[model samples]
Target: MKVQSSRDFKLQREVDYGTPEQNKAVKQIVADIKQEGDAALFRYTEKFDGAQVDSSNIRVTEEELKAAYNHVEDSFVAAIRAAADNIRAFHARQKRNSWMDLQPDGTILGQIIRPLQRVGVYVPGGKASYPSSVLMNVIPAQIAGVPEIVMVTPPATGGKEGIDPYILVAAAEAGVNEIYRVGGAQAVAALAFGTESIAPVDKICGPGNIYVALAKREVYGAVDIDSIAGPSEIVVLADDTAEPAYVAADLLSQAEHDEMASAILVTPSQRLADAVAAEVERQLRELPREAIARASVDNYGAIIVVESLEEGISVVNRLAPEHLEIVAQDPMALTGAVQNAGAIFLGPYSSEPVGDYFAGPNHIIPTNGTARFSSPVDVDDFIKKSSLIYYSKEALLRDGSTIIELARREGLEAHARAVEIRLENEAKGGVERGE
Candidate 1:
């Protein structure tokens, strides 16, 4: 890893709007599925995932769900169950109820919160399984009372015609039974537009590759979607008291995620910066994903020597990283100064991975610099709120002219007339008294 002054370094990763060819390909695939449903779905599943999927075995059977347990150890099941409980307990606090306020004027105004009828969670397969993602995506929806939650993953894993058993086990544990053996843009389309075997969903959530991100963007208007996530990132804001080995290890945790992923360190101590730079190089060689981590550290990773810890905080706010760790002598004191991190880990013991798997917070967070404007996936993501307005005659009579004046000023005659007609009818006693 390279060490530089805070003034000299700026973290930059090109936003990946897919190539024209890839975008055109995604558009065509989405159109084909929207027009030709299951036929196009199966065609692309075979073309991209190399699996022959059809209505006969399109959805995972209960037999497969139960048999998945045989492939995973009892300890693994116990651990997942514990993690699920923590996730549920955490999201349960975020549940909201429909509320109404009744005024003396007999007007009723409130907001009705209702969960989406159905949701689809896409789990990527063929390379590695992310069982943690299953819990992260499904538990919040479940807490919000989503009735139907479905999952879609690539049909084949490592060139074989079966899904990863651990992923199946995670789904079962997370209380999702509607698992589909399809993937890529076609699966995204199937989730947006109903097919013979798969039903349409109100929203889709999960992480995927470039094609999946583009497909989510394509189907966004037809149905809601989670953000188009970028690569993983971790920024460690440490001081002279911080541990070099721990800092280096935490940075590499995200670095190993992808070559495009970024790991950065900002601190005031030049001695600590030198120590962590050396420690990161020593630890990078031992990671199993060495080539990926090496490229990430070489290309995107940096250690910056700042003038002071306050300047370090300013740099972190500018970066707005996906994950942040403050390994200072007084880590909690620095938290109020942070304004842009997706998840903040304070103190040495609160490592990034603790929040990734076992902690109650959602692991699916905004990547790149989007944390400045967006938030993590939560119960709010699965529910929709409708504004409830029950205007009594007295209330409408008092406010009607004001509303008409504003609407007419905006050049919306129909909107003004809608209110005017009500007022005119009430004046003539055409409307019934309590109707």
Candidate 2:
């Protein structure tokens, strides 16, 4: 891992975030599903998932869940439940309340906070099940007081009808009531438009493959989506005092997510940079996901040796990785300047996996450089805020002229009259609004 000495080290901003090919494919999938409905979904499920599926048997049942409970270890179930509790606790703080503002001029403006009513969580299961993801997706919506939380995953080729039971256990703990045996663009289609089997949802969330992301992109306007997730990334900002082994281990943790995952290190100490690179090579050979981690690190990974600590942080703000680990001399001091980043894991002890599995903070984060504006999947995403105004006749009269002029200026005659009628009635003491 060679470090380019100057600021010109970074390659041009050529990272293709979301491609046109992906956009084209997603649009067609959404259109096909909308045109054919259940027929389209079943065709896609059988084509993509290598399983026999239909609209008739999409929802999983109690007996299947019981079997999942039987298959999973007791300790594993206990741990998942504990994780759910912690996740719920963290998102509970994100819950928002409605507000109404009153003015002496009788102007009233406020917002009504309401849950989305229904949301669907997509858990990718083409290779292996992510039980932790089941908790990460559903708990936030539950905390937001969403009435219905549904989950969808690809059925296993080994005759699994729905999501894995360990996933089921996690979902149960997180308060998800509906689980579907469908997957891929079709699953997104099912959630976007109600079929005979799966109910439509207000939004779809969770991590999935390229096809899932493409589907989310296609159905964006039809149903609200959390984010068009990209490859996972972690940027470790370390100093000489940081452990090279720990830094190397943390890099692999992100790298093992996939071949496209990016693991970067920015340090001022040339010795620490060399040590971390060597440690990464040493540890990569000992892992089962070595091929993946190696490929990822070799390709997108960086060990940039900046001139100073401040310069290192400047690059971090520019990248705005999905997971940022601050392991410098004083991580807190630079945190004030970190305007971007999906999640900040401060200190060496606060590793990436801590946020991935156990930490109450959400792991479903913004990716593909979207951390500059987007945020992690949280309670706020599952809820909608609607502004409300309740003005008494006297109150309307007090500000009626101003309201009428503004509405008329905008050419909304009806809007202006709506307030004026109240004011006109108020002058005659017709309606006492507060009473």
Candidate 3:
């Protein structure tokens, strides 16, 4: 582990799975699933996940949930339920209502905000099953008044009849009515196009591997997608006052996510940089995922010694990390300067995982520099806005010529003629005497 400058190290490992060739294959899978429905989904599930999922055991049932609940430890279930309650409480405040404004001139215009009718959430079931992610995804849609919140995850190693107790308990706590035992690109396709057993959805949310992301991209038009999510990443901006051990631990947090995941440190003090580098080496030896973390830090991780705190913050903005931690003299002071970042952690106590698990905010954040112009998954992403317009006779007459003129200029004669015909109809009916 060594401390260097930003220009000295640049590790950019983009997803090699979603190439044009792979995209073509994903498109074919989506088309096949769309055409074959359950048969294709079942075949792909077995082929990809090695799970023998069938129409008989497609969705989770109440009986299974009750049994799984009993299987999980009471205290852990209570904690997950508490987290779900907090998540629901925060998202409930984001619920919106359809509104209309009536003007003196009788031009009624407003917006109708409503939730999507159906939504599918993908919960990755690899090394860890994130029931927290279930809470994050489902609570918002439920708050927004969505009728059906369907979920899909790879079958747990437990059995065909049982899933991970944590995931099952969390789904129950999060108010998810439907759960499917399927994963990988096949699960995404099944949700997007619908199978004989699994119903299609209007929008899909949550995180997954590269194959899952590519499947989401493939079925985008058939169903709306949240975003093309990428690997985990973090950028920590620290000063001399920042603790080295804390900085090292925070950097390694994202690093352990995957080999390609990035953990970077930008500081103004060279001494602080060296200390943090040493701390990373010291801690890396003991972390459970030490080899993965070490490889990530060695390749993608960096420690840039900047000229000043301002320079360090500049590098942070340029990186636009999925997670940004500010460990400085006054962490809040640098928040305004933080033009980029999916979620900004202020002060030493606010570690990256705080936002990931327990935080009320949604954890499905924008990644791979998309934070510069994007935002974390929120109540807004699961919603749709409609423009409500009501034109009174007076309002229409006043605004008709402008519309007619614009239509005529655009060579839309039929549009202009439609307005003209309406005016004439009003005149013929003696509604407008000034005609």
Candidate 4:
């Protein structure tokens, strides 16, 4: 890790999110999938993953799902079930019902809340098995009453023929049965445009490599996506009271995620900064993903010595990290100052991983400074809203003149006439009936 003063540190780091060649390749892949459907999917699976896929092996069978349980240990099952319970309970609170406001003037104004018919969740399956991602993606859609939650993962894990059993078990536990063995931009394309084997989904949600992120960006209008995520990031705001070892370890946790991952420590205390910098280097040697973590820390990570804790908060807001840990003496007091971050972890105990796996909050957080506008995946992502308006004779007549005036002012004669005709009919009927 490198140390620098706040004035010298550059908060933003340049990254090649995707090269032009990669973007062009993904565009071609998406286009091929759109045009050829199942044929394109098979070709890409064989080309990128060296796996075979056809009508017979496109979807995971019930027998394979059953065998998944046999492969995992009993402890893994118990842990996932417990985590599922917590996730369900948390998301259930976010579930909403259709509501209408009936006015005394015989008018109704409301919104109709309905879940999407189907959704596709893409879980990356190349580096490691992320059963936690299964829980994070599926539970919210399930809570929102999405009828069919289809999932797509890579055809192989660790260069093997089949998907990881732990991933299968997690999907089963999360109540997702429609599993397809596909991945990368090709899977995203398959989800956006329906194939003979897989139906189109209303929305797609999850994180993947740059290819997957770019694919989601390309297919946004065809299908809603969570967000075009970037590399993982963590910005820790610490003070003299903060623990050096704990801060170093938490920073490394995210650094190991990828070479582009960032981990920064912003503090006012020079003593704490020196201690954490030393601890990070000492701990980096022991990590199994040392090469990746070291690259990340060297290129993106930093320790900034600020003049005051308030200035440190400003730096944190500027970075807009995916995960933020406030390790100050009064962490909660600075909560309002944190305007941008995907998730906030207060105190030494609330490490980043607590939210990543076990915490009820969705781990699929916005990255690349998008936290300024976007949000994590939630039940609302799986549902759509329709405005419901009912106008009775009395209400329409009361507001008819205003509607006509506004419509005509906009040079919309048809719109104005639509209201005028109804009012004319009501007037003529009243006159004829002598009411």
Residue 264 of model 3, lDDT score: 89
- After superposition of all CA atoms, the RMSD between model 3 and the true structure is 2.5
Residues 213-259 of candidate 3: C-alpha lDDT, one tens digit per residue = 89998888889999988778999998888889999999999988877
* lDDT (Cα, tens digit) per residue for candidate 1, span 1-435: 899999899887967889999999999999999999999999999898778899999999999999989988999999999999999999999999999999999999999999999999999974457999999999999999999999999887424638888899999999999999998889999999989889999999999889999999999999999999999999999999999999999999999988999999999999999999999999988888999999999999999999988999999999999999999999889999999999999999999999999988999999989999999899999999999999999999999999999999999999999999999998998776774
C-alpha local distance difference test of each model:
0.93, 0.83, 0.85, 0.91
Q: Which segments of model 1 are wrong by more than 4 Å? A: 158-161, 428-435
C-alpha TM-scores of all predictions:
0.97, 0.91, 0.94, 0.96
Q: Which scores greater on TM-score, model 3 or model 4?
A: 4
User: Could you say which candidate leads in TM-score?
Assistant: 1
TM-score of 2: 0.91
TM-score-superior candidate, 1 or 2: 1
The local distance difference test score of model 2 is 0.83
Clashing residue pairs, backbone N/CA/C < 3 A, model 1: none
After aligning candidate 2 to the native by TM-score, how far in Å is the CA of 74 from where it should be?
Answer: 2.4
**Cα-based lDDT at residue 350, candidate 4:** 98
- Residue pairs in collision within model 4: none
Q: Least lDDT summed over 10 consecutive residues: which range in candidate 4? A: 426-435
Model 2, 3-97: lDDT tens digits are 55547566333344357877677677778888888887888778877777775577777677767777779999888878887888899888899
Ranking by TM-score: 1, 4, 3, 2
lDDT of 4 at 12: 59
